[model samples]
Structure formats: C-alpha cells, structure tokens
Target: MKKIFIISVLSLMLAVSVFSASKKKYGKEITVKETTKISEIIANPEKFEGKRVLVKGPIVDVCKERGCWIKIGSDKEFESIRFKVEDGVIVFPLDIKGMTAAAEGIVSVKKYSVEELIKSGEEHAKKEGTTFDASTVKEPKIVLQIKGEGARVDGK
Candidate 1:
C-alpha cells in the first residue's frame, strides 16, 4: 500500500511539471488585454477587422507537418481564426493542442477564388491529415485569420 501511494504521488508531481512545461514550450510572452471569442470576431468581422486584439483559448489544431500555424478557439466548431507568424519568426509546436494561449495580431480577411480555395484546402488537408472536399466551395471564400506578431502561452 505504501509503495502504491508513493507511486501515485510521484505520478501526480510529474503530471504537474509536464503541464506547466508544455505551455512554456509553445510561444513567447506578450502583453495582451482580455480574451476575445472567435465567435465574436466571426459575428461582426468588420469591427475587429484590420485591428489588433487579444484572443485566448485552447489549441484545437496545429500544423503537424510544421510548427507554422495554430487554431485557437473554444471548441472544434468555433475554431475560426488561424494564427500564424512569419517564416522562421515564431513556430508553434505540433503538440500544442488543448494548451491555453493568447495571441495578439491584426484580424485579416483574405478573399480567394474557388480554385484558390480548393488548392489551399488540399494543402491544409495534406498537412493536417484530414479530408477536404474542394468542390463544396464553389464561390469565392472570405477567410478570417489572425497574423500574430506576438503570443503568450499560459504556463497553466
């Protein structure tokens, strides 16, 4: 019984350390204001459009192939904005899923034609190991994304 109790205590300690370290490993610290929901941004994109805002949430998806971009939102359904940094500037880890993070950047709206969307979708599908139906997006798509210059990952 003593050995089982000791093992459980050590396991708990290890888990706590890992959780804290995971947040530290992802992004650098940046001063940001209150958290904003992706749904809020999606509701009236023009309000936050071309403006800097603080977005905080769990990472729903990441660039598995490369630490290029991360999807931060409340859940999978609301994973609206894609946060990315410049090449070789900031690289989010592939294992950043479920980690709480804050990103500060200007909200951007990129309009792409059906062909462009299809190609981009295919690339995303290949990188994320998911299936994409490009044909479904027949018209041009106005994509809302956040190009973050700075980020703060809560070492929670």
Candidate 2:
C-alpha cells in the first residue's frame, strides 16, 4: 500500500509541473517604440551602453528561480543576450518563456565574478532540480543585460 501511495504522489507532482509549464502569463502592456534591431545593438554595444532601448523578441530562457531575468534574442535560433530587472523593482513570471516580449531598459555590459557565476549556476540548478558543476564556469564573463524600466508580453 505504501508503494502504491508513493507512485501516486510522484505522478501528481509530475502532473502539477506539466500544468504549470503549459500556462502562460502575460504582463502589463506599456507603450514602447522598438526602433532598433537587437543585432545592431549587440554588434555595437558601446554605442548603446547606458542608453534605454526597446527590443522585441521571443524569450529564449526565463530565470526559473525568480523570473528576474530573461535571455531574449531577435530570432529564436540566433539570439544571445540577457535582460534582467533591477532587484526588487520588477519580478517577471517564469511562464513568460516562448512568448514574444518588448522590453525597454538601459543596456549595459554587466560583469560577473567567477564565484558569483557559480552561485547563480547553483541557484538555477536547484530551481530546475538539476545538477550544476560550478567548475564549468571557468572565468569571469561580461553579460549584456537590460536594466528594465517598463515592458510587456504579447498575447499568446
């Protein structure tokens, strides 16, 4: 009887996760003028650094831990940059993944220490129930993140 109960509980947990992942959360709409290609901005980070820009793209990854950050690219297959909200200022929902979003924020090249990267990797692994090897993050890296001021997710 105990074995049966354990299996039932595991199944229920799996179902719940699946249900949650399938749900999409749309955020408040803000008027933004997206006038630059993300690629152009990325190619010339120096020109746009510290400047606020509106970028539109499908979210490649959402921070599973707190939804405080997202990696959005111009195209699904070719995008590579992360945009994060100022701590405690905005909290995006994890369900926003795969949704097209337009975000306006100041672009900056944020640098991270090796230890800080390790901690972030560990936190993300815990949230996803996976294993992360901190050693894999070998050196300090520059991450281009947008310090968001306002944003919105398009209809799913």
Candidate 3:
C-alpha cells in the first residue's frame, strides 16, 4: 500500500509539471537555430541591424492596448529590448509580463533628435494613457528594437 501511494504521488506531480509547462505560440514558427545575447545586440546594434536573431528572456513589459510589442529583459542588469510585431498580426497577452519568452526577429536601429524624441514620447504616453514630461528631453537618442516575427511564451 505504501509503494502504491508513493507512485500515485509521483504521477500526480509529473502530470502537474507537464501541464504547467505549456507554451503559447504567436505568429510564424521560429526558424532561427542560434540564440543571441540581448546585451551583445544592444551594445553593438549596428552590426546586428537588419539581421534575424533569436533571443530568450523574461517579459518585462507589454503593450497594454493593442499588444503589439513586448520588452524583454537583457542579460545586462536594468537593460531591456523591445520586440515589436505588426498590430493585429501577433497579439501578446498583457498578463504575459514576468513569464519567459523566446522570440525571433530582425534588429532595427533608429536615431532620434531630442525634439523628435519628445514628440514620440508624448505620443506613446498618450497611447498608454499616461502623461509625458517633455522637459526631460536633453539629448538625441538611438533606439534599437526587434521587428518581431514569432515568439513562444511559457504559459505559467
């Protein structure tokens, strides 16, 4: 009887583990075999720009409205990279923040002047239903982001 009870407990644990490890896929299937470090991409974005890369990280932020983008944590502390998908193509769940995700996409780099940054910031803030403080703008900024094509987010 004790052996049977032990086996039952182990079976139940295995079942739960399998169930919780479910994955939710979005967009096309990821074809990239190599994974790139987020830190490396951010540090030298020019080299990676327009190249397809696969990156894995924790989901740090997501678009609250259209779910068109997600910011994933970088290998470096306090750094993250945004993966943006076409609106209505791949919609990430707002609640997916904090979950682990693997995404594949091409890197994109853009330079913005202070004025342009302020305008874009204000527009983004308005879309997010938040207020923007344009006075914070002090310098030109270069943005590196991913044009996401596919992703797989852990269910749990």
Candidate 4:
C-alpha cells in the first residue's frame, strides 16, 4: 500500500508539472526586472529610447507572415506597442493573439519620411491582408517600438 501511494503521488506531481508548462518562451531569456507600462511607453517614448524595458500586455496582434512581431495592448483602450524581433529569430504563434505576453527589449525611436511611411504602410497592409490609404500619411512620422530580445507568452 505504501509503494502504491508513493507512485501515485509522484505521478500526480509529474502530470501537474507537465500541464502547467504552457507558457512559450522565445529568443533570449528575459533579464529586465521592472515592467514598464505600455501606455507610459507610448505617451513618452523618447524618455525610454535606447533603454532596456520589460512590459506585459494582451497580445493584440501578431505578424501574419512570419510572426516576427506582436502588438501588445496597453491597459488603456486604443493604446498598444509593437514588440519586433528579428525575422526567424523568434516567431510568435498567431494563435496566441488573445493571450498575455511578457516581453523584454530595448526601446527604439525612429523617424520615417512620408515616402518611407507610405511604403511601410503598404507593406504592412499587404501582410495584414488589408488596404492602405497612403493619403492619410501627410508627413513624416516618429514611431516607438521595442526591438525584442526575449518574451514569454502565456497560453489561453
């Protein structure tokens, strides 16, 4: 009876560990200890430029082609930040869109000319299977993004 009970306990523990290992880790391991809010980052991105930051949010969008990037939504409605990793370096799953993601990376600030913006917008639209209206882009735009180093995405 004692042997049987011990075996059962070990089996239960193993099963639990296996079942709970749902989070998918990608790229390098997360090293940042403090998490910056996505809204704060979006509101004052220049302050965090070239700095390493950790952030958490719902996976609002993912790169449709190679999963090279994910748009993590801020707590505030209509706000989100994109975490972009090198192509084929860390391909996030498209099915994880509704899940939560904790990502770490350096904040990048860049200015794109109107022509560059239009080109990128068109490319993005093609990737998203949507239409791009270049007329909406009237001037150069400065965008903030995270050049992702690593991420941990929770499964739904």
Measured against the true structure, the TM-scores of the candidates, in listed sequence, are 0.72, 0.65, 0.80, 0.81
The clash tally of candidate 2 reads 0
Best by lDDT: 3
- Tens-place lDDT digits, model 4, residues 8-84: 99999999887667448888999989899988888897899999999999999998889999999998999889999
Which runs of model 3 end up more than 4 angstroms from their true locations?
A: 1-23, 127-131
lDDT per residue (tens digit) for residues 56-106 in model 3: 999999998899999999989989999999999999989899998899999
RMSD (CA, Å), each prediction: 7.4, 10.4, 7.3, 5.2
2 against 4, candidate with superior TM-score: 4
Off by over 4 Å in 2: 1-34, 76-78, 87-89
Residue pairs of candidate 2 with colliding backbone atoms: none
Screening candidate 3 with a backbone cut-off below 3 angstroms (N, C-alpha, C), the clashing residue pairs are none
Cα deviation of 35, candidate 2, in Å? 2.5
Q: Determine the C-alpha RMSD for candidate 3 after optimal superposition of all C-alphas.
A: 7.3
lDDT of 3: 0.93
- The TM-score of candidate 4 is 0.81
User: Tens-digit lDDT track for model 2 on 9-117?
Assistant: 9999999999776444323344566556788777778888998888888887887667788888774357667878865567777777887877877888878999999
* Superior by lDDT: candidate 3 or candidate 4: 3
